[model samples]
Target chain A: MTIVLEKPAPARSGPGAPPPHDDTPARGARALRALGRLSRLTLTRSVVVLALFALWELAPRWELADRTFLPPFTEVAAAWWELALDGRLWENTEASLVRSGLGFGLAVLCAVPLGLLIGWYRPLADLLNPLLELFRNTAALALLPVFILLLGIGETSKVAIVLFACTWPILLNTVSAVRTVDPTLIRLARSMDLSAPRLLQKVVLPAALPTVFTGIRLAGGTAILVLVAAEMVGAKAGLGFLINSSQYNFAIPQMYAGIITISALGLLLNQLLLWAERRLTSWRPQPRG
Target chain B: MTAKINLRAVSKAFPARGGRESVLALDGLELDIGAGEFTVVVGPSGCGKSTLLDLLGGLDRPTSGEILLDGAPVTGPGLDRGIVFQQYALLPWRTAAGNVEFGLEATGTPRRERAALAREHLELVGLGGFEDRHPHELSGGMRQRVAIARSLAYDPGVLLMDEPFAALDAQTRESLQDELLRIWERTGKTIVFITHGIDEAVYLGGRVAVLTSRPGRIKDVVPVELGEARAAHADLRSSPEFALHRRQVWQLLHEEVDRAQELEREAVAR
Candidate 1:
């Protein structure tokens, strides 16, 4: 919660040769300037968030937003702390994790390979085009009743719903990724007399990877979204279930706690995916200020 | 001595699309390029210069006639012929050394040897210290150097370049042209270069072949006698002999350039 302004580095250059960092003082100064700007931006953002939180806490206490509908932020925090100590939050989170993880993992495994095959073979793409168009048009939530009827109101139904929801983004993105590989690179491989499999393995796969990763990240977002919706409709344990139950029982603070947790989890997921993207596609030039 | 390459009555006809006539790009083209000689093909745009290079590179088949490389019929792209495309198609994800290693890997060269050869070729193209830098990190000229290194890594006997320096600025292009000449001298590989620039044709090639418009065929072969002067002097481009050769090639291409422009207008009109 503390923001410390960075201090200038001590002189470290020696007699014969200047220290590597000291040799590039201009670059260091530029980086420091950028860092200063970034810190300022973060400070401003945090101030706005803090102001919003203060309003949330004070407005209800002052009878401004109605305490029955919107409890003070302090009360919601206390409720969240209670859930954490009692292990209720952990238990529900564990259940949700297992369901979401299985669905996401299965979607990635199935969709990537299927997409690559479809992209490589034009006839297969043609065969699936109509089906893809249909599925793309149809929303995953629209099929909830169908899934519940087919798979029954169990873990299978919820996980299946999550999988269906997550598949399209990963699948379609991968197909486009493969198709949009640079033709020049393909020609270069062919000119070297590379075998078909070898060409795909080396040139096409690496070239398509950044786009495919984008699809997976999008799918990751949808997995949580659809799983929450499914759980809200029918589930014994999950963040969504907690929120829904809290609302029914008129525990406004607990409901707010659940929503806050979901928002925090979403931020965590986005950060994790961004870190993975940076590691995988390090060759791409980073956007400069 | 047997010719390094022979093209006999070579012709290419691209199938018409969208209600246009079938385009015969090259017709009855005949040429013989000698072993260890630098040959330049020069013509106006749409004169089937690229089609002729494609035939020689075995990337495409002639609609009729034959292309023989060292007495063997040109069948398909093979390791014996290395091609340098104009755009400097270096894989952006790979380091300069890694790009050079591609052809070596395709030839199944061992990992250690591939690394060593990649470094050697990078140095040959004056990119020794830039081994770890990716294509995007390098300038356009540097990227082309990496591309040239990649093509040369597997040691192809004949180098076929398609306007490789066309994309570079004047200074970089001239320096690279000099570097290319040095490499050609040191390696003694037969080179078939394609370009539309009269100066580039005269400066690079011992024999320059000018092609006619549309159904392209050899208009004339201008023999450049400035090979000694080119090697001896840095300012061979400013020499009288260089000017004479440039004028000869320019005059041959002037009529073809107009005809090609006319053909383009007709197509646009249609």
Candidate 2:
């Protein structure tokens, strides 16, 4: 399909230029041009992806003849269709999501209070900062064996790993958020004769929200990363486990299908977090040029 | 009439980095604000006009003397003194009414009474219809009005303003100044306003206290006598009386302004 792009608008008139027009139809035409621009961008992106898939389906057989290692795009699609129809894919997807959701929820509960305390008291923040940094630096994947030995090879160990991976981002972001709130707002609250608790509630928390939300967004991505790894270690039903099983069986098409599904899941999670961020920060003023 | 504030030999000093370098923000400052007086403090920058306001509001304690409000020594921040900052420091998440309500709720105002008080104060500031709007949604002038409303909602005995209109555009600042005068007349609360703008001090103050630079001592306390509240049609900086007071205050501040500029350059260099 052919795609048509929108034309950029002309520069504004200088001192000697014509008087501005009052035509309503011209405004509507400009809006239509913007819509046309959006659709053309979307069309170009899809066409490029489609062309790549077409090349992948025929290239190995026609050119290199590397059929043993390279799987055709149609074969990969067939493998995806089989997984979807057999009900195993749905169960595996649900397992991964459940672990990620539970772990993220736990991390939020712990990080928020710790962050508030650290952010509020300078002395406390100095004391705990080093310990937090040390803990955050230790890799989540490296501790999987310890967790499995301690909690046994069940849901707890996997969920624990996910929580550990996600908590640091939320805590650090929350502390920064609280610390960076306008000092003027704090003084205003004091001038109002707000009690200590009331001042924190009325002034401190609200001002820190936009920054705190950034941490939550980062933690969402980290949760997904940790979940996939945790699921691959000892999990029975998950996209990660499917990838591991397919690799052992030399089911190359099935491996590609599992990887594609995992990527799509991660993309969906990122979009959801972005949507929430937009909604929560609706009160913030739009930046001017 | 209420006892009003009495400052007795108040001198505030702060230590600097190299050996007890004291900044005499206020030097043996003694002044009495009569009940319901609209007093404006004017000076060059860093002359401690703001420091004086902070003392009156009980946000900062005097280093060597006393600040007595209604015959009692002022202590920590209290609801009896309301302050409006130059920056319209509104809580970002709260609606206009919510910000007003926060002040009331903090001082243990009844829950049922807060909504009514919030609405009334907002209406006084000509923002009755904008009660539900957040600070970000309003224009700069409107947000400052909301801040004024939030400050006044608690009905403090003394209103301390530290160049509250300095951040607005000229038109908006003039309009808000007019609104402030109307509010002052309506409420008849004691006001201590601090500003570097000569015209603003002359226009708003019943009396103007001009300060010298650095070791900020009060140079002169001149009565404005442009009436307690200007007539609605009176020109702000125009006419004979306004210019007369403006000239008087300028003459007193001119030399100090030069000294302040020199000090500013020295500070920047250091």
Candidate 3:
């Protein structure tokens, strides 16, 4: 959730190593050892985060920079507590979530069918491919001013910008997923004497799914990023607008708190998408080696 | 008597690389495959064995002449001609049963009947236990079995296998050949199998058609009436009579292989 703009030096030495262990084990024991290693990694990650936060609090108190601009970690945490007690933080977070969800949902709904058509029908692809390339290359953020002019600086403009930003990745992903499916599979379907609709339903869509899921995941990230930028432009609600207002009003701790909430929301959405991907692709075998 | 497949002076030619001269894959290739017959076609690489199968299966059109199934000219791919490729082209996304069901679905068979038929075909191929498994989960031999089962599920009049066991290891290849013969015998379907392996051709075919080099023409159709070597592919491989048939087919095909190699050298020289 921390918005670390600066990169820190990479960690080298860890706390301690376990005592020299036996190399040989039964299959069951080896599996348990792997699980143990995973837990250890999780433990180490939390410790590292705690250490970094401790440094953030101590260094600011020790006069690392002007405390007015860069508040101590404790001050930011206190500001977060105040926001939570007043219930505005959750309201802002929920507003941003709603915007992102609506935009991303719209993008997916529009992209998939269009992408499937473009991918499956060669003549359509031939006609529209150039236009698609042009639009995909044109930055979605670049259309923000235009959207504002057309729709005004309200929720609609912001949602539209998010949709625009998120659409390309999903559309392109769907196209590539369909296009890159093994030709042998298509030929096999045809040899089976499948109708065009049956071929698309049975052969094309399932094969394209893994790549489409990947695109959707990327689109999720894009949606969050675009939503924040759109909210920063002009919005009365949402964490992004909170961040903007806090900075303008010289509430440094509150600004940092808003930034932290946005980061957390992004991380949480990514994790949720990852879980969905795992659930959908359950047939994919675990790595053996 | 219904001749399962009849090709009348079939010819197929591919357009050569950006030139007036076309590459003739087949020329005046006349053949008749009867019901319950196992015919193997042996040819050097690029001698158009696959092209001939394509023509028979209505996968591609012969540039001249006709390919007929039961006296009717083939218009396009149909369920009457089922093909098994060397690569075992089962859709990777689908499970073994799903792959079998694809053809049934395409042909608009009732769902319950299709499921029963798919099960029966898989059982016939000895892949009964692997129905829910995807292509990736199965071994190469198992995958080919699934493909063969899929083809058979359609109950095609003729099964055309284009080197179905070519990608298999020698042991798997021999075993699959035995399975194929058992299935062919049980179903009483006509089969036209293609292979470059001399031993395989002799082991599987009642009649072996040896083909000449590019612009391929049939050189000979050597018939093997070894009743003792009929079904057991493993035992047939070790028999002296099987060796004699292999030698005869090899002799018929050797000149074609040499001619093909010479032609290849000439093309590479250019």
Candidate 4:
């Protein structure tokens, strides 16, 4: 007499886990009630966002600040629409995404494997860690001029700076992640006569994944932020370039549109990474509301 | 059965830490576990009971002397020995069956056979429908059952349990204890169950080994004589024979517990 749900059984451990102990349940009715409540919560939560939008629209229309500089929300949206329709925004966004993708991809390739090795062996970590600490403490943007001087102000410098900024969080976090795998699990694996390699592959990696993925998500955000700053300095086309050019050319609404697009891009990238994290680490009990 | 496991003058010492003197956990300890015997080792909090189990499991070497499994010396962890830790120590990310399959996979059993064996072991521990549940999804009792199933699935001859049910509630503990007895009867494992509970030792052990306080040595061994009732796994806790055995083991342990507490008190005061 067992009923298997499609979703992995969310046991009573998680926040939104089913209340199996409760007797009075028409499953369909309960789901509807939950959905209704969720919709209500969504509406209530949107009030703040809507209120902020209203403030932006009214403050500038009423001349709270100079309308020439701080145009209303609608004007910015309209300017964004024009740019999007003409594909100007698209062109710049593609350039920015390409730079970010290359830099971030390279960082992952270099950092994760390096982090694993440095974390596993004590002697290697001892040899490399002081050098890593020295570099990690030196912020990436502080080396912006140095990067431009070395790699030049082309796409290379922008991508290189983004890679530099993204590397530390990914690498350092991975090292700690491997280091902090519960010793109990290691003992259990050892008791099973697992070889050293098998122990790393099976026990250490899976245990360290949730933390390691956390590092990756942090780096994803870093990739965007650092790339934008680098682009502002010397890129021909990117969200940062668009924003800078619009401000200089006195196209205030276009600048606001570019700034808003950057925020949206950051939010979307975070969401995508979070989705991947959820897919891969589904074994972990997720915090639900 | 002859002594399947043997410890001859076994001792372990912890190196001095933070300018403190070295702590001797065990000294001149002698013990023997017969093949297919349910030998429960009971002691005070700091009597090196766990250290003894670690030595037998070959996770740690004895500081002096030696531990022997069969005729050979115990050198390191092997599939022949399985340990059930106090904390359940389950990989939280793995399902019950997946966890059971961990050892099977280590043994290089094919994927399909591993699943079948894992399911069989999970069923043996009365977790048939719980094969897919993660450790967090299960209750404390259920989690420990999965751990037991996992240790047993690898077909280890000697199972070293270090307070496996210590974290469980009283009712869960008793039920698990009964379940363990049934499993032992079925499997015929050479089990060395460690506990601080006198009643548990009396109930589970064919012979209970009472260990003395800090710098532990074998204080006494009480041969449980519950006979027919124990064999049936019946209502033996209330029986007069069970009472006598409980009292006997408690008496042997009471003095050592006090001595260990006094030493702990002095150390904490310092």
Q: In terms of TM-score, which candidate is strongest?
A: 1
Write the candidate numbers in order of decreasing DockQ. Answer: 1, 4, 2, 3
Stretches off by above 4 angstroms in model 3 are: A1-35, A44-48, B231-234
**DockQ: which is higher, 3 or 4?**
4
What TM-score results for chain B when candidate 4 is compared with the true chain B?
0.97
Candidate 3 lDDT over A183-215, as tens digits, reads 867767766677888778877888888898898
For residue A166, give model 2's deviation from the true position in Å.
Answer: 0.7
- What's the lDDT for residue A142 in model 4? 96
Q: Per-residue lDDT for A1-289 in model 1, tens only?
A: 2234445555666778656564467766766887887888889879988999999999999999889899999999999999999999988888888998899889999998888878888899999989997997899999999999999979999899888888898889989988998887877887888887887788877898899999989988888888888889989999889989989999888899988988888778878988888788889987742
Report clash pairs, candidate 4.
none
lDDT of 2: 0.85
Chain A superposition TM-score per model:
0.87, 0.84, 0.85, 0.87
lDDT per residue, candidate 4, B143-225, as tens digits?
Answer: 99999998999899999999999999999999999899999999999999999999999999999999999989999899998
Go through the candidates in order and give each one's DockQ.
0.72, 0.57, 0.49, 0.64
Candidate 4, residues A1-289, lDDT tens digits: the string is: 1122223223477678767655334554566666667678778989899998899999998989889988999999999999999999999999999999999999989998888878989799989999989989998889999999999999898988988989999999889998999988988887777887888888888888888898899999999999888889887899999999999999999999999999999999998998888888888776773
Residue A118 of model 4, lDDT score: 85
**Highest lDDT: which candidate?**
4
Per-residue accuracy of model 2 over B114-165 as CA lDDT, tens digit each: 9999999999999989999998789999989998998899999889999999
What's the true lDDT of residue A87 in model 1? Answer: 97
Question: Which whole-number lDDT from 0 to 100 does residue A35 have in model 4?
Answer: 69
Question: Clash number for model 3?
Answer: 0
Q: Candidate 3 or 4, higher lDDT?
A: 4
